[model samples]
Target chain A: MSLAASPAPAFTLYDYVLSGNCYKIRLAAALLGVPYDSIAVDFYPGFEHRSEAMLALNPAGTLPVMKTADGVVLTETNAMLAWLGLNHDPGGRWYPAADPVRGPRLVEAMSFGAGLTGSVGLARLHAMLDWPVDGAAARRAGKRDLRQLELRLTAMQIDGEDWLAGGTAPSMADLACFPYVALSPDAGLDHDGYPAIRSWLYRVRSLPGFVTMPGIHDLHELR
Target chain B: MSLAASPAPAFTLYDYVLSGNCYKIRLAAALLGVPYDSIAVDFYPGFEHRSEAMLALNPAGTLPVMKTADGVVLTETNAMLAWLGLNHDPGGRWYPAADPVRGPRLVEAMSFGAGLTGSVGLARLHAMLDWPVDGAAARRAGKRDLRQLELRLTAMQIDGEDWLAGGTAPSMADLACFPYVALSPDAGLDHDGYPAIRSWLYRVRSLPGFVTMPGIHDLHELR
Candidate 1:
């Protein structure tokens, strides 16, 4: 049945199976019960995304572009999350539409997650693959980022809330951060020094419909 | 005296007089006419953000924390903009509540804006002060970022849109990138190569209630 005839727009995700960034959008869609089709982009082979067809979808050359039946394509996980929260979850649990108070905190987390978490993830991925970056440099950068991550995580605990921010329910802040925060060790950074971060990771992972990032190879299995 | 008595909550912004980051928030508040109080933080002599009192306001130790009437402290420029757009401007102008189609494109602009712009800003500041960074190395980085930014601007030109993304009116994407985009000359980068960016800067600079950054000295003017 065409979603156009129905009340909601049909959803489709142009994604790479293992990307944490892609997973963030997919998890949100699944939790919201928004039916979406996933089309794979083989980043390793540089196949689909570089083709002229994919370029037409997103010029930024990134994965996980979400297409809506209304002929709209949503890219960028954080922005997509914001749109989904506003449109789908009217009650505002996934996103607090009314809470201007929590807005900056959530935005900071998402920005930090996208940047710092990304830096750490890259260093870790290079280490896992024994790539070009020297082991010592990778570890040093990982530790530096972890220290900052710990500072933010400690703040989360001091706020005395179960989630990263002070909301009774976890908003995008918690979701934006925890995925990579938990996986930092896999990238060769130690999390033992940050117990609060470890606990927060556990809390997020324990959430219903929580899907782990498929390792670099097992992406197909998860999808 | 309080906004609790009214429908919309009163907005207040805690700012450091000289920080460009803080300027983005103030600019947003001014354009929205949300009526905010500006609380100033002293960034002189040493890093004021590391101070205990400041930490209490924002654990991340960043400025431009917005306190809503209900007393919630919103941190980060992009996040605060998102909240304000959703809460105050239902008109879909400053923050565009309904344009999911352009969501990802806007996020990409903002992300590129935050990271690349911040880096270029720092490089310029360092160059202006005759700081220690290798000139060639820094220029290489600045140029790399400029290439990415140029591509984005070119694409915006193709969309035949004046703003970065979503809605006929400019939103956070434009504001988020405007500060550094306008100041590219300071980084020894040339904007003459990018016609759309030049036009976009004019558009942003002409916004109602637009305020310039307090430079590197008078950041406390808001106080």
Candidate 2:
């Protein structure tokens, strides 16, 4: 055997296949080339995430719970993104929490993404899985958030920036917001009026090592 | 004249006096000794935060809008806290996003704090300002969050850690969650049920350079 140090320990992601929040972690790992072992959890009909055992692991009863190699259990999806970026990304551009100008914007965009999970994400769940939520309120809030996102993207496009945090390269901020926005059609909200958001979504999907979920798919060329 | 350079530029904070979210920024600035100009906006009777000018600054029309020295407008409270910690704290401990273990936990705590704003914060608004919201739902949610917070603090105390992120010195995570949790009494959620949370709150209040808002007060020693 060759004399070499052991490979870094892979993260254990307690994930659900249909969860956009779970997809956020998978997409971040793929883009950053970080390795993780995903244990599929039945989130929909099974409601396994809310099971006693899962609640013991994460009191929040949320999907995409990440247990690090060091055994630190992270319940928030954005936290998982931050951990992946800070620990795995060699270029240090994915998180950029150190840069004064970009850091706050990054945090803002990530927070906005989390808000989208409440709005767009909830609406999508109501539509797709027949979840008992105020669908009308969720849709209204989703529309408002989508409009805000479009306006921000339009401003960025006008200012000659490509990503959410206005950095030359995409950061965790982009990944944080991408999944739900891309999956908005499931909520009966389309990108017809959001040209800027459409363009931005395309840009995110075009990134190297980009992955796809059940709702969001890769663009395929016609044979 | 001495050859010293000009002082760092001060940030402009669009604030509301009674807002726990706004107090978060004020408290962070005080703790970090970061100077900033506060522009008071009547969030309650005046509804000044939703005014057109404020909307122009932040489309979200959120209180605690922060205009940085470099002219970047930040609307999220947690973002402002991250900015203050990352840019102002010389010790590098307040926002330790570089440390993989602490970083994810910090993000998790911060997100939890944001959620408390929705639960505890909304409940407080409904109770104090008579905001048109489902007070019962808000209180129920707030109680659940407070219980979860108490459990987390209890676990941290068992681990011999004082702060939310389980760090020796308190990080931004503590500050992010402090305001809403401290102000939960305004929502009729008392600290009598949460001994660990009450102890943690006292510790945060006792920190050097601690500041207070309307509902929260300084522990004055009587003769």
Candidate 3:
């Protein structure tokens, strides 16, 4: 389960250890058993992601920039997730982009995950790193978003659906959303108010090959 | 190219005539020649999109909700575009979600387009409908986004690619981004400074079945 560098990996990820977005790629690669090389960047104190070299790789100056062995660069986290799912998973369950019903739903959940980035993600950055964002506004938005997510998760639970896109197996949608929602406590938004989200987070962590990030830990061995 | 109601349309689109997000759906349907019934919701002044009825359909309270005849509802515009492209377009050029290379790029551009909804789209809403957003901040972000788009478009043009995802034909990426960038003038961001964006807009408008919204117009008959 170790992500130690392979002699020759398929992808190279420019990652930040504390970033949920970056952890998403790492966790997805781990769960799918896809090997990749990781080059750590200091996003907080160093702001290396915004440096000229990083910007050359990803003009958006975002973390979790992924480059394939063939020189294809992916700057968006969801896009990177899609690429990993579509290319690596032999069973095609991870992406399922060709499934007419599930594909759009997957895309929908992925977009919702990006919304979480602006809300919970921003609030976390502000709280942890004192990033120059409107912390109060971000927390407000994050609370609203978490509430909405809880409602959806409750509905899905009622419908007997275990995944966000209502598929038998978790897709990129789950991977896209898992990190931020799992890390919401760092933003001062605790899971006590979101039972369904807590359950979903537990299920995600219980998955085989699940990896841990700074704020989110792997499930206890006894559990 | 007329979008007049069919006796039995395959889908129903909850629409707002002036909304750039809604236009993204209408334009995608038109480009793919997919027939749909339009249910207009008064977004401005009325805020019908937030009304109880629309809330029952889309809790997100966003315009451009699409329901398939089979009763599948798509709340995200990019997801709706993906559904239309994946389901309607026989050639599959519009989605290309199965392509290892193009699929990721398409998702990346689509994500970028959603960012436009925050920047250019918010600024436009502030200017046109006085939506009570931070017009100044929205404008600043809009300018930055437009500049980034221009740089990418310039690079694409240099590489002899006509579309956003670097595909031979336009994909959902192009449609997802076309509306906001085309409507940037409403936000006080003109195309005079971005030659590459201007050309890309022209190319998009020149597509065979391009439709027009309030702020965007079709090419003249002579053209």
Candidates' RMSD to native: 6.1, 2.5, 3.4
The ten-residue window of minimal lDDT in model 1 chain A covers A214-223
Q: In terms of TM-score, how similar is model 1 to the real structure?
A: 0.77
| Model 2 residue B102 CA deviation in Å | 1.3
Model 3: CA > 4 A from native: A1-7, A221-223, B1-7, B221-223
DockQ of each: 0.38, 0.80, 0.80
TM-scores of the first chain across all predictions? Answer: 0.82, 0.95, 0.95
Q: What is candidate 1's lDDT per residue for B1-223, written digit by digit as tens?
A: 7555533536777777656677777777778877777777776546677799878877767777787777766767777777777677757466543344555556656776787544676776666656566665666666677776677667667777778774467888887887766666777877788776666776777777777763321223423
- Which of 2 and 3 is the better model by DockQ? 3
Residue-wise C-alpha lDDT for candidate 3, range B1-223, written one tens digit per residue:
9786645787999998988889999998888888889999999889899999999998989888999999998899989988997788888788887778888988999999988999999999999888888999999999999999999988888778989988568889999999999999999999999999988898899999889988886788426
TM-score of chain B of 2: 0.95
Chain B TM-score, candidates in order: 0.81, 0.95, 0.94
Q: Please give the distance, in angstroms, between residue A102's alpha carbon in candidate 2 and its true position after superposition.
A: 1.1
